[model samples]
Target: MLAVSRSVTRARIAARLPIVERTTAGRPTPTRTTKERTMPQHPKGSVLEFDLRGTGSGVLQEVAIAGSEHAVRAEGHPAFGGTDSAPSPLDLVLSAYVSCNQVTATIVALGQGITLGAFEGRVQAELDNSVLVFGAEGDGTFQRLTLTVDLETELDDAAFDAFVAEVARRCPLTQLFERAGVEITNAWTNRALARV
Candidate 1:
């Protein structure tokens, strides 16, 4: 596990940057704790915030969160006239979905007394780019999402099946896709694979 913290304070907002505001009325966002043998407890509610500054070329942008010393660059896809130096926003979305599933699965495994050898998830999506790129008249979104997970463990088939079922049901990313009307195909391989 990894500890994640955030503080809501004034960040340096340079001139000419467009800022989006989201208001929440509740407790401060909870900090995530890591390195414990058990999974971290979930917060009832949390407030997340972030900022992005355009890089002034090819739809590129630099992203950061409050209190973070590092930032990541994002850019539009090359097909849309971007330089393709960094990942497109849609790429980030798919990556986040897979990454979130990996973390959530690990936590579920730890809680279920399952000793995991290795695990990996790959996510891919098909998008209807006409709306964003060619000015089509329908909603621009993913037409389908495919998630494949390779997992290694010593548990019996029944136990592994149960574990996978629980993880699939509890993974927040899966629910997000469902809520967004994106069709998802989930495949699991309960065997070892080359580790990256």
Candidate 2:
């Protein structure tokens, strides 16, 4: 089970917002009867935890959130002589960066009063494994990270650029990459011709 240390009650969170349901046509429609929604309010400065135990040997491990029963397996890269049964830790980190960008960018855009229509993205990272695997002196970090996003919105070109700039500034993963001196690139596509 995943144990989240909630400083606020669930009722308080539920009281803050009405339940919204997606219709068959994929439009968000508010329901007449409000329901207690999971993750209704975002908790700030919350301490998150993850617990993991080695499954057997060979650098394979099973991980679980403290209050959650679900677990996932992780393993070392096959290039390091271990069976590639699951994603490596580095792979997970890369995935986290990608997922974080998507979530943060969308939330920020919505907060900026931009009605989001559709959003899709792809992330790619280039890494040099020689440092970690071959005992090289240099860093074993990502040399470059790139994000390509297709956004369906009515914002004009200037407004779209501004939105993307704000997203890049606000995204934690983007800042992390910047702080770590990693080269990051972003490409965006507007799906709608109408301007706002």
Per-model TM-score, in order, reads: 0.68, 0.68
Residue pairs with colliding backbones in model 1 are none
The 10 consecutive residues of candidate 1 with the worst lDDT sum are 1-10
lDDT of 1 by residue, 106-166 (tens): 6676556555666677987899899988999986878899999887776677877788778
Report lDDT per candidate. Answer: 0.68, 0.69
Worst lDDT window (10 residues) for model 2? 1-10
Native-to-model Cα distance after best TM-score fit, residue 158 in candidate 2, in Å: 1.0
Across 1-117, the per-residue lDDT of candidate 2 in tens digits comes to 111223444445445443334354866454333463333245642222233444556678787643345676778878776578789877887787877776665666546656566
Report the backbone clash tally of model 2: 5
lDDT of 1 at 6: 28
How many residue pairs clash per model?
0, 5
